[model samples]
Target chain A: MARVVVDVMLKPEILDPQGQAVQRALPRLGFEGIADVRQGKRFELEVEGPVDDAALARIHEMAETFLANTVIEDFEVKVETSEGPK
Target chain B: MTARPSPTATLNGGPTGRWNVRIGVVTFPGTLDDRDTQRAVRIAGAEAVPLWHRDKDLKQVDAVVLPGGFSYGDYLRAGAISRFSPLMETIIDQAKAGMPVLGICNGFQVLTESHLLPGAMLRNNHLHFICRDQKLRVESTSTAWTADYTAGQEISIPLKNIDGRYVADERTLDLLEAEGRVAFRYLDGNPNGSLRDIAGITNEAGNVVGLMPHPEHAVEPLVGTGRTDGLGFFTSILKKLVNA
Candidate 1:
């Protein structure tokens, strides 16, 4: 089995209004315990067989084309394992 | 009656330059939608020129588009570093002189960073990366980039982003509304907690426009969403060129 991890976030310069809103509401919610809140998404994929460079690139392409919007987000892909040929 | 030199000829020396309008689409280090923006311009029957973020010149393109994508990996801010690019200086000057300019998604963030338009984009209310087919009402049609759309015309476009909220001082928001400068408004639910549900806006002269939605992605019917509601933006500029 092969495992892949994807981390998605807004491009650094893109304003993260959602994060700001949450920050603003944190105090109002009587949860002043939070210092800051920046939000993003994470995905984990398990694929079959040994993960090769080509397969990794395909996964990246998929992330770019659909999984993430290159406009506001960037993604990092991590391969956890690639077992021997099935 | 005397005839004026073709706009294309005055801009770029291309063959059949008589009627074709040439537009430049700028690509920053991390730009993601430059290719799609160029394709949209081409499909609209205009020549699309690719411009680099580091380049100081616009290459004499009649109009310009700053496509979406992270620039400089959003290191300092989403568009903060990119706002200092040499191309932005030229674009700012040209846009001030009435050249048409459009900014989409990350491009919109860059514009806000540059202070070309008054406001800033912030994180969404939900604190999540929101992606969906968004409905927007064209709030104003006077802008050179939006002439083909009618005011109040609701159209659908693809929206994908994390930092997509629009914000400004209350007074500034009031002025934008009073002056009818708001270019587009979000319909249905607010995607990113944008103030007053604003999806887009234009400058006073109606030459520069900025919006958080990805219109380029909606220009093609064969692509993911298969909605072409965003093609009007490209066609509108072409019509403006033809009339000019």
Candidate 2:
């Protein structure tokens, strides 16, 4: 089995008020020198068979069509193989 | 161009008596304003048809209204999940073919997600949910839902939402302004930090309009802010359908 991860984020130009609020709170908690902060979503998908180009491409399509709005967000997909009983 | 009759006059049994305009109101999971929207339609002298989100059929209604609420709990993103619902599939097609579609508040979010209108809504600049009586200026009367309102008319309606800030590419904003497609502009103060203070906008064909304010709530005189300024939306569409 293979694990696929998709991370979706707002475009750099768009304003992220939620992320900004978190960043502001961090300063009050004595966390300093953080240049910037942005919040995004991450999705993990488990596949049943060997991961191939076709499978990766389909996952990318899913991310583009459903996981991410594309208008205000960008996404990236990565593959992580499950290593069991190491 | 002939002078248009007042919506009040038409609602009071104008020349066209007992007009049979059927307007469909859609309800998705968590949709809260469908009943109020139906009432607004009936008050404007049109038949209100209830449409379910999972149903592909539109029931032969002349127009559709996507009312306000946190559909699908506004999961993933506001309106993202609901945009792919069966009802929206038909709504998108009909909207493209010039059938009137009015999206209010969360409905506006759905329209944007469906790509029937441009831009995406973001969280309010202050990161808080705001609810109040909002003043807006009617910027265009060419759309199917704004014909009853004169340009530059200022009216107050109730607005409540967290994701009400409207954002779009600069080029699209310029085009909307150039073509006079901006249907409503925020007045007195910008409620949610929307770009250009835009409260609502219509599509290029003037058949689709999406706004963040709740016009249905303002249609009754004794309830919800006690101003019927929002009744014009229903009356405007009825006038367009009857004349068409």
Candidate 3:
């Protein structure tokens, strides 16, 4: 089994209106303890295949090309043997 | 008897010489819909040319399209940084010369940022990233990019963005209304707190148009919403080119 992790974020310089809205609303909801809030999506996929470096690279490419907009977001992937000690 | 090829086929290079309508799709650093926009242009029987933000020339394309996507990651504001791209300078000149230009979502933001269109995009009133099938009424059929649509014709398109709300000074809004420059109006409900449910607008010359919807994504019948309402935008330009 192989694992892929994907993260999506608005570009740093971009104004995140959604994040700002949540930050302003937090205090009103009695969550005054929160200082900052940035919203993003995270996805993890488990694939069944021969876990290899080539396969890991393909997964990363797919994420960058379609899953995540590299201009505003970046992602990292990890692959490991699903079972047993080496 | 030999069968004659359809005019469209001949124009698009079937038996006759190449008649592809060359369209340039501008890609800003954070643009998200450049590829999809190119595909849609191809489907509309036009040749799609990929244009870079740094390029000063428009590559001799007949028309230009600014695809939706966060340019410069929507830095400072949506389409703010992208408005300064070298390509926009050429587009501004070409648009003044009556070249048809269409802007979608983030592209719309860029048009506004460049002052190619009036009004500004602000944070949505609900203040959330909205992705939905939105209904819009075509208010003007005079724009080069909207000629195929009928006035008051309601169509559905995909709208997605955090700062998609449209805002303008009251006088500007009034002038737009008086001059019939308002190209589209939101129907059903306003997804964003746009003043007067305005969804899109066109320039005074009717050559430049901008809208906060993903018309490219709506062209394919089997896609997300399975609605072809947005296809009219592409067809309109094609018709305009053929007539010209």
Whole-model lDDT per candidate: 0.83, 0.90, 0.81
What does candidate 1's lDDT look like per residue over B31-119, in tens digits? 99999999999988788999998898778788899999888887645787788789998888787777889999998988887778888
Candidate 1 per-residue lDDT, tens place, A1-86, comes to 77898888877755565677878898888888787676787888887766889889889997875456554568899887455436
Which of candidates 1 and 2 reaches a greater DockQ? 2
Per-candidate DockQ versus the true complex? 0.13, 0.76, 0.11
In candidate 2, what are the lDDT values of residues B49-164, reduced to their tens digit? 99999998888788899999999999999999999998898889878877789999999999999999999998999988999999999999989999999989999999999999
lDDT of 3 by residue, B145-241 (tens): 8888888998998999988888877788899999999999999999988888999999998989999988899888899679888888888887787
Q: Quote model 3's TM-score.
A: 0.72
Weakest lDDT window of 10 consecutive positions for candidate 1 chain B: B1-10
Candidate 2 lDDT at B183 equals 91
Which ranges in model 3 have alpha carbons more than 4 Å from their true place? A1-86, B1-18
* DockQ category of candidate 1: incorrect
Give the TM-score, chain B only, in order for the candidates: 0.93, 0.93, 0.93
Give the fraction of reference interface contacts each candidate recovers.
Answer: 0.31, 0.69, 0.25
DockQ winner between candidates 1 and 3? 1
- Whole-model lDDT, candidate 2? 0.90
After superposing candidate 1 on the true structure, give the runs of residues whose Cα lies further than 4 Å from its correct spot: A1-86, B1-14
Residue A22 Cα positional deviation in candidate 1, in Å, after optimal superposition: 8.6
